[model samples]
Structures are given as C-alpha cells and as structure tokens.
Target chain A: MTLASALIRAHIRERLAAALALPIVALAASSIAMAGEPVTIRIDNFTFGPETVTVAPGTKVIWINGDDIPHTVVSQTKLFRSKALDTDDRYTFTFDAPGEYPYFCSLHPHMTGKVVVKAPAG
Target chain B: MHDPTDPNDDPTRPSRRGALECMVWAGTGLLWTLGGGLPRAVGLERALAAEASPAPFSFLQISDSHVGFNKPANPDALGTLREAVEKIRTLPQKPSFIIHTGDISHLSKDREFDDADQILRETGVPMFYVPGEHDLLDDEPGRAYLDRYGKGSRGAGWYSFDQNGVHFIGLVNVVDLKAGGLGNLGAEQLDWLEKDIAGLSSSKPIVVFAHIPLWTVYPEWGWGTQDGARALALLKRFGSVTVLNGHIHQIIQKVEGTIAFHTARSTAFPQPAPGSAPSPGPMKVPAGELRQHLGIASVSLVHGNEPLAVIDTPLAG
Candidate 1:
C-alpha cells in the first residue's frame, strides 16, 4: 500500500473513534440527569428525621408522620403546607424551584426540616 | 396544709385529717348555701364519697378535641365531640357552662377551630378555653386561638372569671413547647396569677383550669406543668380550691390540703395511663370501645362544700 493511502486510512479510523465517543459521553450525561428520585422526610417522636435533604429540582418530597400525635408540614416561606397529618399519614410536595424550603410541623414548631433543591444537569 | 382528701393519694380511702380539715374550712365557716333548680341533697357526710353537695351549681369540662386529628386512634374526633355535647345536653339538670382544659384543635388551623366551635356550640352552653401545645402551632403562635377566644384574657390567653359562686381561672402553659417533654407555665403568668387571686377572700371558692396536669402525672411525656406547684401554692389558702386539668386525656384525681386536683378525659381520644404506653399520644383502643374511654367532667359546687363533687360520666352512658 502507498504511504499516503496508509495515512488517510489512519485519519479515517481516528474520526470513527471520535464519533463513537460523543454518544457515550451523551449517555453518561443523560444517566446523571435521570438519577433524580423522590425524597422523603419522616416525622416521628415530634421530630423530622433527616433534618436536611438535598435533591434535584422537581424531585418529589414526601413527609410521613409515624408519631402518634398529629403533625403538619408547613414551609417557612409559604411554599407548601400540608393539612394536619395523623399517625401514619403522608404528605407529598414536589419542589420545582432551585432553592431551600425550610419546613416544620405546625403542630410542633420545634420539629423542623429543610429541603435543598438543585438545578438538573442538561 | 395536710390534705388527705387530695385523692391523689388514694380515692378509695378519704384520710381522717383531710375530712377534718375540709369540715373545718367548709362546715361551720359560713352558712351560705348554693341555690339552683336541682334535686334535694342530704346533710354532709364525713367522707366526700357521698353524692351530696353543698352548692347546687354544676359545670361541665371538655378537653383535647383535636378537631384536625384524623389518625387511627380516633378518626371521627368531631363526631365524638358532638356526642359528648349531646351527652351534656341530656343531663337531668343543666350545667352552668363548660370549661375546656385545652387542645381545641390538633394543628391550630383556622378551620380546625371553626369545626370545633360548630360542634361545641351545639350544646347551648358557653365554654371558657385555655391554650394547648397543639393549639399554639408554628407560622402563627396562638393567633388562631387568641383571635377566637382571647377576649378578656390576660397574656398568652390566661384569664379569670366569676361564676355563680365560684371563681374560675384559666391558665395557659403551652406558649413554649418542650421537646416531647413537660410543659412550662412561665413566671409572668405565675406573677399575674398571684396578683389576680390576691384580692379574693380566702373563704371564696376558687376553681382553676389549665390544659396540662398541674400535678406531675409523668415527666417523661411532658405530662405535668413545670411551675404548676407555684400556681398551686398561691391557691392553697382558699377553703375550696378545685384545680381541673385535661392534657393527659385520662382521669386522675388528687387532694392536697384545701386544694383538690382533677384531670378530665378527652373528647377526641384517650391516652395511655402514665407510663403504660411507650410515650403519650393517641391511644388506639378496640373498635366500638373508644367512646367508653372518653367523656366530660361535671363539677358540683355547694356554697360551703368541701372537695367539690366531681362526676365523670362517659359519652356512651
């Protein structure tokens, strides 16, 4: 084979490798974006378990009241508020904005929790 | 200062000292008698066990409505509260009024208060209220309760009013909630309570009502008031002092000197006896038996009665 022909073939091979790497990189990025899942905060014994939680924006946050007494999930900034939740009751709020939502049990002010929402990767 | 009638020691046996002390304070002190349209009463007996009462006025006590509560312990709390009202309406003799110990609502929401009012108002009797831990919730500390019932009340919703012949003082002890523990009646309220009662004659009958138990029912669940002893101290001089409370959601009675302490049952649900459950909360009972454990308290005061006649009749009966 001629040396010029050999160089051209090598160039073509390099181009093929580059094309293959682009999709693989794209898939990795997509997977990372898919990692966002629902988060939950447990209310038991007059406290918010996992007092702080961080999640991607649009992630649903759920509060389950395991304590015998009734409780409420109310946001400090009026972002979200749940009705009085009795034992084993559940309240869900999907945080869409990228910011912090500090919450507490309206029935018990000392019981507090926070959810940190992060922007999703493109 | 020795109070055997305090039934806090033993309801089955009324101590001789307590009976004698009661007779001394209640019996020859004054000839005044309570008047109302009630049945006849027999002469006084040594033990307060006899139903006979010196004063003819009767008042009802209801507590812990938890109107917003929708738990398994008692899903139909409002219905049960209505039932309690119905029971009160059917009494052979109408009670003068009702004094709620506390916990009118679970979440202290505006609708919760409205719901409770609708049910309680049906009984056709006025009700004096005190705040509970659940009533002074986050976002707004006591605004809902105070807006609805704070008129004529002192700081934090504590107030005193005069009935037919008795003085009723409502104390608020839930402004600051402890973490799953005991309640606190701040010094400010204590001082106000002191001055409020300072002018009353020692012979005048005093009836005090607060949400939490004035006595130490159990410290683990914050069942008792932190400064209840201080409030009770000032009330000791009165001839007939009845201190009734309702946070515990169960019936427990005691007597110390001239002061008689009683905790009434909740209209919404029942809590485990002190230390019976892992913690104090809504105690789930078997089906069809919840009403058996919940009821209102009726206090009978005769002008010179010692150890006011307290009757706890269940909603079912």
Candidate 2:
C-alpha cells in the first residue's frame, strides 16, 4: 500500500479508539460519582463499630448484626426503624438529607450510633 | 470480689453474707424459713423432713425459655424447658401458680409461643407473665407477645393481684428503652405503679416481679432497669418487699433494707457472668453440662406470718 494511504488508515484507527475510550472513562467516572462508597456500621459484641459515621447526603448506610443475638437500628426521631436483625442479618437505609441521625438497638438500647450526613462541597 | 467498706454497701445491707448463707442452705438441700423479716437457717435434716409440711402458698418462677433459640450454646432450648416443667410437675407440693418472667420465645414467632405454652401448660398451674426484649421482636414490636398475654394486664402486661395475703405486682420495664440506657419502665408505667400500690398499708407484704433486674446488676450488659430506683422508693414503705427478676439468666440475690432482690436462672441457655467475657452472649458449655447451667426458681410465702422464701433449683447437678 502507499505510505500516505497507510498513514491515513492509522490516523482513523487512532481516532476511533480515542472516541471509544472517552465514553468508557466518562461512564466509569459517572458511575463512581452516582454510587458513592456505601458506609457500613457493624454490630458486634453488642456495640456499633465506629460509633459515629460521617457521610455525604444520599449515601447508603448498611447495618449488619454480627453478634449471635439479634439487634435493630431504630432512629431516635422515629425517622426509620429496622425489624429484628438476627446473626449475619442486614438492614439498610439511605440518607438523602443533611442531618444528624442517632439510632440504637431497641433490644439492647445501650448500643448506640450516630450518622452525620452532610451536603456535598460547593 | 466485694469491698465491705464501699459506701454503696449500706451498713444494714448484708447481701453478701445473706447470699453466702443462702448458698450454704441450698447446698445442703435445706429449706430456710424467713419469719418476721429475718432469715433463720433451719437445720438441714429437719428442713428436709419438713418438706412434707409445705409453705402456706408458693409459686414457681421459670424464665428465659428462648424456645426458638437454636444455637451452639443450646441446640434444644425447648427440651431443657420441658425438663424444667417436668421438675415442676413432680414437686412435692403443687405451687399455687407459676410466674414466667419473660423471653418465652427467641424471635417472638407465633410458633415459638405456641410450643412454649403447650409445654408449660402441662404443669396445670396458672401462670403470670411479663415480656422480655426477646419476646417483643415481632414486626410490630410487642404485637405477638401482647396478643397472647396482654389480657387483663395494664400497659405492656403489668398487673397486681393479692394472693395469700401478699400483694403481687408485675412490672413491665422492657419497652420504650432510651438510647445509651438499659431497660426502661417509662413514666406511664411508673405512674400506674404508684397508684396500684396506693391505699395498701405499709404492713402489707409486697412481691414485685419484672423481666429485667429492677436493681443494677451489670449496666455494661444492659442488665439493669433505668428507672428502677423510683419503683424501689415506692416500695420502701412496705415491711417486706421481694423483687423477682429473670433476664440475666443466673441467680443473683441481694437484700437492701427491707427489699430483697432475686434474679433467676434460665430454662434455656446460660450467659456469661457480668464482665466475665468481652460481651454478654450465650455461653456455650459442654453438651452434658448444659443442664447444670439451666434451672427454675420457687418462691414460698407462709401466709402473712413469715418473710418470703425463694428456692432456686437447677435442672441437673
């Protein structure tokens, strides 16, 4: 083939690869932004690990009961509540607003934890 | 270890000594008499022979059945409970009634309640009930427990009745618990308690029973009632007051002033002693030793003449 034709074909191929790569990178970035890291509050030994958590609004928070006994996540202000969570059972809630949410295990009320949800940076 | 010089140890409070005496009596299989508010350790042989002469009236205390619990600590919770019931059935004298101080079910399932009721009913003695945190685990909180046991009971299945000249009050303190606190008897229940005991003369013998220990046992394990002192204050006027509780699943007896507090063993599994383990959960024992950790309680009242007697009998040696 002629050198000029070969160079044109190589340029076309490079442009096509860039076009596909840009969307793929953008898609990955958007997905990461849309679904932020989910915060987990573990229930173990009748206590909540990290007793307090700070998260951005719309963050999904999951509570897993790792103790042999059952536990529950109940909001102090009656905003959300969970059914009894047996061993290895999980309950999840998403915080969509900026507020301090305090919760505890209803059965073992001494176990308490707080979630501080803040708005994204300006 | 207990410090004898601790200010918290009131001079008149001889709980440690009393408990030791009680253990000595129980160890010998002797029944002591509590007469005129004083405990007199009867001779072992006479006490054994005196079993034929039963107390005026007595009731059985069975607690923490946890019927639906199927764990390594105890895979057959119901089987142990039935064994406890059989012990009750074959008692030398039939108890006037039975007091089940809660945890009738593990997950608050209807089937668990039914199974417990069927097995417990074989004793053929009337029963009084108060709920435990485990029993209130239904989708709607205490719906399952209340539906079956709330009849004629005031808020959360607390009530009072007079039997054999002794006033019996069942208090419910396992609901509406506050964050960072232990068990709770909210203001409403406390109000009911005040009015319920009003008009009764100070000489009246009072028996107060609840699911959780009315006095502080182990706050770290959530084994105490937040507002229990208020209730005790109300009962302070009585000449003789006995408080029976069962959530801790072990026998712990304490006598403060005129009031005597007793916690009973479980018909299900055993829990670690306060601060004995990192956390208070079921303690798994060897399969053959499970029954040694589980048992029942018997409370006797010799009409209005004697101080109350509580006998704790284990299922096995």
TM-score of each: 0.68, 0.84
Among the numbered candidates, top TM-score falls to 2
**Least well predicted 10-residue stretch by lDDT in candidate 2 chain B:** B19-28
lDDT tens digits, residues B1-317, model 1? 43465542354543322232232111111122222312123334432334344435667788889888877889888888988888888866577788888899987888889999998888888888998878877456787788899999888999998875467899987765443335678989999998999998675678898988888877766668777889988888877677889888887766666676778788899989977876676789996888878888765544322433434666763
Instruction: Give the range of the ten consecutive residues with the poorest summed lDDT in model 1 chain B.
Output: B23-32
* lDDT tens per residue, model 2, B1-317: 34566642344543322322222112224355555545566655765564454555667788999999998999999999999999889877688899899999999999999999999999999988999999999878888888899989887888999886678899899999998898899899999999999998765678899999999999999999999999999999976688889999888777788888888899899999999998888898898888888998776544222344545678887
Best by DockQ: 2
Worst 10 residues of 1 chain A by lDDT: A103-112
Docking class of 2: medium
- Per-candidate Cα lDDT values, in order, are 0.74, 0.82
Instruction: At residue B275, give the lDDT of candidate 2.
Output: 98
Model 2 per-residue lDDT at A48: 94
iRMS values for every prediction: 4.9, 0.8
Every prediction's TM-score for the first chain? Answer: 0.72, 0.72
Q: Scoring only chain A, what TM-score does candidate 2 earn?
A: 0.72
